[model samples]
Target chain A: MKSRVWLRWFVVTIGLAAVIHVAVVWLVPVVIMRVFMSRVAAQYGVNRVITQPLPTDLSRTVVKPSPDLLYGVCVFDVSAGPVRLSIMPPTTYWSLSLFDTNTDNFFTFNANDLKVSTADLMLGSAGDSGDAAARFPSARFVVTPHNKGVMLARLLVLDKTNMDEALAAQKSIQCNAIKRGS
Target chain B: MMTWVAKAIGVLVVAAAIAIGSAWAVLLHYPLQTDIANGSWRTSLAVGSTSADPYTRARVALTGLFALNPSEAIYFSANVDNAGRPLRTHCTYVIDGKPFVAQWWSITAYADDNFLIPNPANRFSFNMGNVPTGTDGRYRIVASSAEQTGNWLPTGTGGRGLILTLRLYNASPEILRQLSSIELPSIKLAGSCP
Candidate 1:
């Protein structure tokens, strides 16, 4: 009887361990993204573009930051409504990337993808109403998997000579929440 | 009855510990399931993609959050040298390569903690626009703790493991399609280490 009881306990332990392992693995990314989004929202607020200077050893805002690129970040939440992003593409190599709450890079476009100098984009939740599309006909509507996510603009700074130009280009990037029915 | 209850509680504790430990070990130490190894470097097309597996998503979130999709940029990282040796901060390395088929490219060295190594020169990376190439259109970057004459990438004074990340922005279609077969920089140890 004791041996049978011990075997049963062992089986239960293994089953519980498997359950915990899967749960932890699945939750790790979601938890990390949540914490990161919260921090970004706290420091920079949601639906606002903030240009960060070139990353150095001193910059710990993000891990593994590239020193050769200037970063512009926007933490966005579309629960209230859709958010609009406007970017002035720099002449040099530049790209804009959008990441969802799960840290997935769902959408991205570079300067080559743009026909004009400026890119106007509207980010809405996947289940959101399509009324905003007709309202903002000029803006390209992008449906995000999650209501909360991030938009990152990267401008390559070739050298010290072009730092000012990169800064100016990043400064012109704007992200704001679209009011309902307006 | 009391002894049985105590044993059951112990078993539960051990099970929970094993679960957490194994999960963290896989996430932190083990390589991703879809990693493509080329020379000493490794990359994954699933990085920052919605179709990534659970472990890949967790690893990317921990190490490289907000990374662009492979179409926009491809990230290759090497923690070892050409001879299959761990890259140490105390050792000097020479990275030699030809121009990449991309709009822009750069190589940056970071410590094991995934942060830029603090150095006196404040130099962190060398990009295509900054690195001077040879007459043959090849570039050689000397990564060392002590500053070298030309194309010196500081490795900082900390005696830790070194990680080198190569970023290819706007890579050509051919390069993206054949990522594993592409030619990458060769990292050679410069001299004998102490």
Candidate 2:
């Protein structure tokens, strides 16, 4: 009888471990993403891009930020409708990527992603009104997996002396809400 | 009975232990790591993509939130040398890099805290845009706490261990499709690593 009881306890431990693994694994990303999104929204507001100050040395809250690169961020919300993004491609290296609420990068556009010097994109969810996406050429339409997330834009600063110029170029990039058929 | 109460507490303690222990283990070891250049350098196969596994997403969220997938940019990090030893702050290293099919590339060093190491030199990274190549178009970067002449990346005077991050932006699809077959840089131990 004692042996049977030990066997049951062992099985119970293994089963509970598996359950815990799945729960934490699935929940951490969601919770972290939500907290991050809330912070960005509070700091920059929604549907806008805020170019952060260059990461100071020995000061980084984000993971392993590249010191040579200048990063700008926008928290996107597509619940009301699609959002429009316009960027003047820098002469130097630059890229823009969109991440869904689940922290998955659904769409990414880089300096190479641009055949033109300037890129205009309309991003929305599949559930959003089709007319909002129709304003832009179909080729420039990107659909997110969810209505809320982040858009991260990175511009490489080649010379430390020319950082101000790079920030000016980064400021030229525009983001705004999309109004359908207006 | 007193025995029954003790058994119930035991079960709860066991469950809590399992939950926290497994979470920590997954956080430390669950991300997919692909070795490059004889395991001297490595990158994640799951970063910045929709298809990343749950553990990878969790780990990335904790460590690196904005990591681009291999296609946009492939980031390789190294803490070991060509002979497979931990890189110490006191030790100097020779990074022999190959010309890649990328439009732009760079190598930056970060301390153990994942922040740029504060050095009096104010030199944190070496990129194609800034560093000058040898007459033959080949380049070499020195990783040391002491000052070196060309392509010097200071690991800081504090002499803490550091990680080197190599970014290849706009890499050709062929390279990403077959990372193992291609040639990456080598970080070999220079002098003594005591």
* Per-residue lDDT of A167 in model 2: 87
Question: How many residue pairs clash in model 1?
Answer: 0
State in Å the error of residue A155, model 2.
1.0
Pick by DockQ: which candidate is best? 1
Off by over 4 Å in 2: A127-129, A133-139, A160-165, A179-182, B1-6, B29-37
Scored by TM against the true chain B, the candidates give 0.94, 0.85
Best prediction by lDDT: 1
> What class would a CAPRI assessor give candidate 2's docking?
medium
Report the lDDT of model 2 for residue A158.
77
Number of clashes found in candidate 2: 0
Tell me the tens digit of each residue's lDDT in model 2 across A119-170: 7778887755467545566437788778788888888887877687678768
Per-residue alpha-carbon lDDT of model 1 for B1-194, expressed as tens digits?
Answer: 99989988988798889999998898777777789888988899999888988888878877888888788889999999999999999899999999898999999999988989999999999998999999988999999999899999999996899999999988999988887888899999998876
* lDDT for B147 (candidate 2): 92
Q: Give the root-mean-square deviation of each candidate in angstroms.
A: 1.7, 2.7
